[model samples]
Target: MTVAKTINRKLVKTITQRSLSTIAPQVRIYEVGPRDGLQNESKFVPTDIKIELINKIAAAGIKDIESASFVSPKWVKQMSDGVDVMKNLPRAPGVNYPVLVPNLKGYDTARQCNVEEVAIFPAGSEGFSQKNLNCSVEEGLKRFKLVADQAVKDGLRVRGYVSCVVGCPYDGPIHPKGIAKITEQLFEMGCYEVSLGDTIGVGTAGSVQRLMREVLTVAKPEQLALHFHDTYGQALSNLLAGLEYGIKTVDSSISGLGGCPYARGASGNLATEDLVYFLYGLGVNTHIDLVKLMEAGRYISNYLGKPTESKVNRALGDRFKNHNDIAKMASCDV
Candidate 1:
């Protein structure tokens, strides 16, 4: 159970670097396209297409994929067949496919699918709780505790999610104290890692820095991940801040095709293509193929009939065209 001290030391060192040098050399991207991205879709995506997207994400060399969530159909109709989606998806080698489970009922359904890893979400804001889960923050955590305990006994790896850590539509300016307390509860409940989410996409770098400063006091930076929405177009900026603080794990979507239903007009999670481009440009190692990843993003965006939210995808599209044109001219030279 011991991680080599050398590895841990190097990781900690990478996290301490300044924003200009903050790329973690080796970043872990948790792809949430199938679950977090699709959960907000008004149109129901076919199960077959969902499986295909998981395969495409895996093919793009993303090591962690949030495959689906086990929630009620009434709430998230697109993810109603989470168990079936898991059973049918192409299981790529060396990829961790984690599903989101809200409570013991969701966990029970996920376990029936033989899921080895699952994530539970507890809101950090009370107003968001009343609107989203129809319960108090404490009640949500109590339910999460039951699910977390049972999942551990069932030999499942649990990752926790804390939503609205920065701003809430119903309540503004959440304190770091509340975020830290909730995160501590998640970790205490046996979560292997806790992903702090800016569900409404209202966080700036300054806010994210403060939030991380508090959360890290209780949770190790290595055990934390950032899940940001780009509503204010500050996701990359905040991500930069996370890197500076030694947080190497991030959750993002391809083509940026999601938003929280509870918080309208939010730009959803940061785009995977954009995050990959940002890291790769800095010579940081993410191991994702930007060109292929863009293709994946483009494929999904095309299917959705929407222009991509990724700056990198649009730029790459232009570059791809130029590359093809140059190849044609070179053939003429021959």
Candidate 2:
């Protein structure tokens, strides 16, 4: 059956108005630096630094920040202190902190902390599903469904993630059909929004356009978000393709701090600095202070003992060295 026949009627509005050449005047950048960016680190980032990193990012005015992930500490060592991170986090007004909940147990733990939102990640390819969650795609979705159900009943928002939307490191090529099916299921399971991820950073503009065609069939642009990895240097190009589909919410990390475990360090998501710089140039309103954002980026990068992977961050590196030199950084970046 076509998507119109299979998906919810409320979501099946006019398809003719689905594409756009220019981005929306207002865009929402979902900040994932504190959780996804720090998940695979060889050393555990102190809870102090994690809270500080998240607070600093919030201070820069990002609305939706993915602050922590409630996964097995055995698998993701850096996120072991998820509880402490949540407890110690200074509640910021107008800022929503969403955490990743991979299972029902994780979701239960997170709910006790009074989290307003939770995200569930399911893979597009079978190979990745097995490696990442040790289950088939179908089984993983079933697991996330339980979490989504409870989250809704608890009066919390549920966000879904479909990883490896273009291609997977282990699974190779992914057909748009699979992504559409998964996206539909997430929506059916009560996900308010689903962010499609190119986990290994292998997606190109052509691939994104093709994949989004199928995705938009099952999902409204407003109900979807884009998350691209920059490993192949095609993140901006791929983002443009998603923008054409009228997807205004995008996932990004501070200073490009996260990377796929398969790849080297800190190369996964699009750098928030680069994304903001692009949007600002386009006259898109993100309501984020570019100068303060770089300061936050520099904070985490400095503590991580690695240089920032953001091109925008590097171009203005000199200014960040002197935190109070906001004037210098602004002159250099904007």
Candidate 3:
């Protein structure tokens, strides 16, 4: 037992060191604020506010933003105005706005809006696939494949999302091989990238490392992205684990504004402000302005009537207040 423990520790250390050694100089922050973030809001977010949010995110230097989803209004009321959100947002040059398309119907709507990219959501766990998507995993993938094929034929870029990659609320821990098989299928179906999502935020660094090791065998690290929720306060650490594996793209929401309506007890996503702050500290270039990003977070959080979930935002606000108070004291003495 002692020898086995020592070998395991050495293995983990070796993996960590190797991952850190090849960290990319820059990472792509795939902002999902306008789509995934707002989709779970109970109150209907006004179309204008959603548009303003996307514009602000773009202004803050997010190159890739998920503007909206073309899902049914009856199912996802918050995204009922997906078309309007895409049409009204002032399109910035060199910025790519992708939208979610659940099937051919949603894909057709997005294509009519001249969407450059579209994403399909498929779950890694059979239980989640049945519960959330209302279909078996195989059936869900079959549906996504049709959409992916059509999108690629229409000259649109396709991205794939595999939810519950780490563990599922309905089904316990997911097998890493399950995630790898699904990721491989998505890549085979012409998806430019596939994001592995810890939908319920039940993942830790060790789990993420183990999952990535398997998925990386089927898909290149560059073709994968990590989407983690902060329910367990381990999102950032899991993200760092992914980075060590050379995964360059990350999915995050501003103000941490997302939850799975179908997954009971699930929390919001990893806040964009927090992700940017961590990346900046690592000397990794995201080309995102932290102050501007927080401003956007504040804008959305105020609209939602909730305090920003980003710890970095709160800390920065306190720092600014302290500076202001010190300046006021000096002025009074003068």
Candidate 4:
């Protein structure tokens, strides 16, 4: 056989071998665009705009959407209108809106807005915790514990976020054991689910696999979710590793907006459009309409006067343009 034919045969054999192991049948996309995706904007988005964005995202069939953050406006001015956004949100049955609560004060603010669920973040790297939260890792966890306890007492479901799971801007690479410890603490503190964030977006498939192996020891795959940034272009690859490890939930932003304020060079969260496209190819049901989701992305991107950061969305748009051109040519011929 020719070299090209031999190479093609080897590639086919590799794919067939890999396909023998079935991927998960269903994936829960946790949309954080309105909250995490917009928090980093230089100019504050209007409350009306934020509300409309949330409504559009919900209409796109994303059940779990992080709507806003209850943190101090002094720290994140973009989210100053969190209360108004929550109060004015068009409530839809079966859609659960969760807000980020930084401390007990934030939790109180979220409760006043009648938030059904709240998420608290703790940094896996000590340096990042100190830099981001202005406190040591131990102190940050203590604060999170207080908030988590009170949130549970108030009958609210709590979600935990551990940032810089793979590497940190300040501290460099993070050991998997450190991530496991924090994840275990969050679960023990009554968090229903813990999301592991590659805050700086520096994780590769090998690093992600190593981290997952350690984290899965203390927490089950069912209790965990993966949150990755696309800074290094490894977000999708890292997500594939997570899926292979039985993680069914993922956190993504719409149109790939927003990045970590503390991590200077970090990019936005993994784009929801891109994640959905990847999942669909694997036969994983996300229960979200791609067209509707793209519309939402386009609306928000246009409102912000920025091009979409989602590769899948851009490619789809290009494909549509080509099809339209072909149709126009056919019409002229007729």
* lDDT (10s digit) by residue, model 4, range 282-314: 657777877778888998999999899998789
Winner on TM-score (1 vs 4): 4
Q: Report the candidate with higher lDDT, 1 versus 2.
A: 2
Checking candidate 3 for backbone clashes, the offending pairs are none
Which of the numbered candidates is closest to the native, going by highest TM-score?
4
| Candidate 4 TM-score, true structure as reference | 0.91
Clash totals in order: 1, 0, 0, 0
Question: Considering summed lDDT, which 10 consecutive residues are worst modelled in model 3?
Answer: 321-330
Q: Model 2 off-target regions past 4 Å?
A: 1-22, 262-266, 318-334
Whole-model alpha-carbon lDDT for candidate 4? 0.89
Per-model RMSD to reference: 8.4, 8.9, 6.6, 4.8
- Give, for candidate 1, the lowest lDDT window spanning 10 residues: 322-331
Inter-residue clash pairs, candidate 1: 15-246
Tens digits of per-residue lDDT, candidate 2, 76-187, equal 9899899999988999989999999999999988987889999999999998899889999999999999999988998899999999898987878899999999999999
